[model samples]
Target: MDMSETSQPTIDEVDLLLANARLRDELEPYRDESIDTSTGRMNLRTENEYLASMLAWERAPALPIASWFTPVLELPPPDSLDDDSLNELLSATIEKLYSQKVVLRFTDHLSNRELYKIIYRDILPCCEKKVEIPGKFLEWRCFEDTDTWLRYYADAVERRRYQEEHDVRMPPSERPKYRRDLPH
Candidate 1:
């Protein structure tokens, strides 16, 4: 009797299931108030992807921030600075940040002083962010409520026109760009 054509045994998914369970179990201890509170549960796969990223970050070696910003940077106080001097400093500082892959946006409306202050204070202080993976960047969101900018920063003509064009009863929900992609 020829047994060469006997059907091959099917591969069991038991290992895969067990592996996923193990990954989840290992990740369970990491779940806390700080485990990506901004991350949304779009679906099982999305949740799993986030968990996997968390695991990878936890496992990856942390690189000194100097690896990103060399020689370090020191900025004088944003106070008592003229527009020309502040602009020069801001340009250099922004370029340094760009070199580190940290981009700042939505700052066109900010004054030279305000922008420099944010860089000198909030931004420079945050330069110590741990680098686990390469190519990841930190985008400093200066504006929490864009609506406030539109309402307060906009000229009277623009605000009136906007009010005329859009519903004034209720403003549209403006979620942060980072949290927008996250599943609610």
Candidate 2:
């Protein structure tokens, strides 16, 4: 009913309008660029670089959990019978890597370890029977210590090199020469 009360409402309205404008400006980059959202895909390399930069920002950490796990889990399983069995066993081992107590405490719920155990003991063995490779010899080398694991990891690098040499054909003695005198 007074002059101050009327002016207060006007000030509040201006404040709300300013806040809404700020929010809209903040969200401008995420707005739809195309009419068909389903067809729109982000550039993976650019996104990855952007994410790396963001993770390297002062307030954040670069914990690439997905990248670390992808190579190990996404590789094709072995073809031999024993290797096939080992693959099944490895799958089960991965599933049960975190114990029940750890899962319950961390996830705040119970998980079915029985399925994992069954896969390890039963399903894996059946899968192994179909493979042509010697299962017992492979199984003997399956369990290893941290040093052994590192050695195996290094061995994989050699395997990769061998695969690249065998599969990729390159012309001999055609290496490019570097010119170092031009740039400052």
Candidate 3:
């Protein structure tokens, strides 16, 4: 075999070389003991792959959530959508968001319209770091309150512990107004 034939790198190898160089360049400023002084546990290829993934996450762009979708997610005004239509759209939208690794939490307290409105006006339009790291999901909280968790998720013992810890009277626990089977 000709020496050139054996020496030439394939297209995939070239791409990997370029990507590794780019990752090294991007990580240069942040170079520290964490990566450079890492214990000799991971082999060179595995270490480089892990470093490349961390660099990719660090360099991800922050853009409107809707722009993350292929065709771009757009929903009509919540008021115009009837209850049935809103519910249908909400379910589909939740699935779409989940497909993009976005999860909604504590949504049972909001009505269908309220939840939809938040997804439409707040989450869909909000700018967030679009990290493509696997096993990483962005959690969107529909309502902001510790009391909500205490009321809805906490067991009787947990609630009593919270009351004792905070020395505050616990509100009577009631079922959330609307039930949504959202992704965790």
Candidate 4:
């Protein structure tokens, strides 16, 4: 009923305008004849979101996993920690890593010390692209051997196929040594 209310842009309209401006700014440095940003093949919102995510990922810094946290995540020597202390610290550390979007997979086969050592010696020191986008996570597989994966996770048919493909006999399947209920 009021001219002021009709003249003013809604919140969603303002947000859309802001998003379009951001999308244009993000597209500026990446301009090329070959880059197809046309909305004919995709929805404008989806395309804009995709381009924004691409720019975010491209601009993300590569840093050590430990440095991702404030003050850095420092762990005590594996030898100095007793079994109870090690287990508690390991669980807390796993939670902390998950909070930073770092997930440890197929770690049940490893003992607490082994997993902790791997996290400390390998994962903490490793440099990874730190993409701080929502729903983005880095899955670190603790096991490298396909045999371990087959034994622990694969079904009978999958295991049989793997054995046939590799031309090697696989050991009988067994359950994981310790399965922790952690966020995926």
Relative to the unseen true structure, what is the C-alpha lDDT of residue 25 in candidate 3, on a scale of 0 to 100? Answer: 84
- In order, candidate lDDTs are 0.62, 0.33, 0.84, 0.86
TM-score of 1: 0.51
Per-residue C-alpha lDDT of model 3 across residues 88-137, encoded as one tens digit per residue: 99999999999999999888888888889999989999999899887889
Ranking by TM-score: 4, 3, 1, 2
Candidate 3 global TM-score = 0.69
Worst 10-residue lDDT window, candidate 4 = 35-44
Q: RMSD, each candidate, Å?
A: 9.1, 22.1, 6.8, 5.2
lDDT of 2 by residue, 115-167 (tens): 33333343334312111221111121221233323333335565456558667
Error of 3 at 150 (Å): 1.8
lDDT of 3: 0.84
User: Candidate 4: where is the Cα deviation over 4 Å?
Assistant: 1-41, 160-168
Best by TM-score: 4
Clashing pairs in 3: none
- Better structure of 1 and 2 per TM-score: 1
lDDT-wise, the better of 2 and 4 is 4
